[model samples]
Target: MKKMKWALLMVVVLVLAACSTEQPGSKSSSDNEDAGKDGDKEFKIGLSVSTLNNPFFVTLSEGAKEQAKESGAKIIVVDAQDDASKQASDVEDLIQQGVDLLIINPTDSEAVVSAVESANNSNIPVITVDRSAEGGEVVSHIASDNKAGGVLAGEYLLELLGENAKVAELEGIAGSSAARDRGEGFNEAVDGKVDIVAKQTANFNRAEGLTVMENILQANPEITGVFAHNDEMALGALEAIQSAGKDIVVIGFDATDDAVKSVKDGKLAATIAQKPEEIGKKAMEAAVAVLNGEDVDADIPVDLELIKE
Candidate 1:
């Protein structure tokens, strides 16, 4: 009987202890279970820009940073310095930082697509700003319509220089989406009306623009107008034209700070102004939306306008 009573007491004690040990309202357990259904991740974005060397890209970066500040989110920016290989390495580094999302302004659309694909393979959503990737699963692309801007520039150039005018074409980087689209639209607008005396790629650099424009001027002294893809190139072309003592009307894209001032000063005749800041902000916002698992448009185009003195 004593042994039976002892065994019964031990059973009751074990039952009480088990009941006490039950974690009915444990925060960690419930939190882990609800993580997928109810919780959001700590927001962090990776912005990989082609180059911070240009004021346009710098303004873009500032815009994205400002938007992130408003949302209390963090962004990690990497500058590729216009190097495609370096851009890919930078993307990998950002991935190692555990960035929740990625924004890429590609140096070269096709070259950057590899990095973009890697991000996609990792299940990280990518939003391209200003330049779209040639190949990748991009969540969204925020940019101005480059083709339309080019057409606008071409039409305006025709109005300024007139039909049967000799013009030199200053192209941007080869294999870039911007260059391709702009060239396509410009060609469509001016193929029959304008005579392209010299078409050369300056790689969208100011110094190169000067050198290339000099060569084109040397070859075609009859060139009456210059069409540069960007302002930096246009400024360089302006310098070259002034040096040659030629009265050539210069039109450029990207109404950057220098370009705007130049336009005001009547140096550069006109430039197509794309809202780069708005593009940056919209891109960052799109990334946030994607992180939250909300639906977003695949293409989000910003507005463009012509800026003239």
Candidate 2:
């Protein structure tokens, strides 16, 4: 009887040991912990773009979307339609959706401050892309050096036109940091070297640029060069100049697809390449880093290049 009882006890001990041992294709407690550390949970990111009408912003959004997919995150994109109030509303809606983070390309720099602050109030980090907010806490600002790009445009225009060059400026939307910085740099580079016949705002609209360029041409018939804040305006101005039978060295920013083709076709004089897609990729990476509690630079700059025919 003692032997039988001892054998039963040994059998019970062996059963318990087998039960505790991990089997093939079975997950142990440590395996589950490791899976958790790998971040099975998907993070949602909100992207508020100023406008998608421009091909540049469209490419930028596409880049961010691709990065989000690769990083196992979701991104929601909203278009402001170049309306500051609408952009603010879109941001409020995004905040209500409990987005983990926000990437904003503001229609207007000053108008976006309130939206940025709202994201800040909710403890959600904000990343600015291509444009910046005048105020509010931003985890990162990703863009090219607009002022430097402008200087490059100016210097190249000077090279093409030389001294005594009479140029007109086609400015972008009012209250935009891009317009302000680019204009400042361009003016600084060409100050006292060229005759700035006319400078006006085209609101960065191609049609408006056409109209504005037409008016500028009428007012300054001797205009020999043009510097538009963006490619849309530059292309518009090009159309106007071509129609008027005038030969003007038109320099544009944001070497968009159309602008690049124009340069290759010898229609556009030159353009500053901002690599909008890269800017978008960097912004998404920064968003992921911020969510992972990793430190990112306050300002992230993409490379810029001068594209000439």
Tell me which residue pairs clash in candidate 2: none
lDDT tens string, model 1, 133-196? Answer: 9998998999999999899899999999889999988999898899888888888899999999
Model 2, 1-309: lDDT tens digits are 999999999999999988887777887676555232255556789999999998889999999998988888889999999999999999999999999999999999999999999999999999999988999999899999999998999999999999778999999999999999899999989999999989999988888999999999998999999999999999999999999998889999999999999999999999999999999999999999999899999999999999998
| Residue 99 alpha-carbon offset, candidate 2, angstroms | 0.4
Q: Each candidate's TM vs. the true structure?
A: 0.87, 0.89
Off-target runs (Cα >4 Å) in candidate 2 are 1-37
- Evaluated at residue 18, the lDDT of candidate 1 is 83
**Compared to the true structure, candidate 2 yields what TM-score?**
0.89
Q: Which stretch of 10 consecutive residues in model 2 shows the poorest summed lDDT?
A: 31-40
What is candidate 1's CA lDDT for residue 230? 86
Count of residue pairs whose backbone atoms collide, per candidate: 0, 0
Say which candidate scores most in lDDT. Answer: 2
Model 1 spans with C-alpha error above 4 angstroms:
1-41
